[model samples]
Target: MLNRDWHKTYRMPEHPTLDQRVDWHLAHAIACGCREMPDTIKREIEKRGLAVPERNRPN
Candidate 1:
């Protein structure tokens, strides 16, 4: 189920910085379940040693 409300409210920036991408993905993980974070983003997060939110984990 797409979270239209969250999408409408939280558009990704045209040219996002690394921190912005991380923040957006973290928030999106909590607010919506439309899709998984992209592999590139996952790798970046891992490189930074940031913990993915619990809700974002695949079951």
Candidate 2:
């Protein structure tokens, strides 16, 4: 699960640009185990009632 609250929890890069939210979210998702990401990683993805599984699921 990509911590949606990464902006609050992780140390953001210095001088973040105005149009970098998607990159930020995608990075966070990858860190959390979102391997097969969709075409976009914006608010819509999170708001569309989708889910990202955590790492190491019991198989």
Candidate 3:
């Protein structure tokens, strides 16, 4: 189910930096299950050698 309340509370910023995108998506993975993290964001995270959060992992 979509978490409309979470979406309303956590809008992504315009032209967000990579750090902001990563942080927002990580939080979203915990708070909402509406969608998968974007591939671009995942690539950037891996490129930076940062571990993807456990909650964001695919089943």
Which prediction has the highest TM-score against the true structure? 1
lDDT of every model, 2 decimals: 0.79, 0.48, 0.78
Candidate 1 pairs with clashing backbones: none
lDDT of 1 at 41: 77
1 or 3: which has the higher lDDT?
1
Candidate 2 per-residue lDDT over residues 1-59, each given as its tens digit:
33445435654468855335445555565565333444555444556564543332212
Candidate 1 residue-wise lDDT at 19: 86
lDDT per residue (tens digit) for residues 23-53 in model 3: 8987887777468888888888788898766
Ranking by lDDT: 1, 3, 2
> Candidate 2: what lDDT?
0.48
Alpha-carbon shift of residue 26 in model 3 (angstroms) = 0.6
| TM match of model 2 to true structure | 0.28
Clashing pairs in 3: none
Q: How well does each candidate superpose onto the true structure, as a TM-score?
A: 0.72, 0.28, 0.69
Off by over 4 Å in 2: 1-10, 13-18, 33-59
TM-score-better candidate, 1 vs 2: 1
Model 2: colliding residue pairs: none
Q: Where does candidate 1 stray beyond 4 Å?
A: 55-59
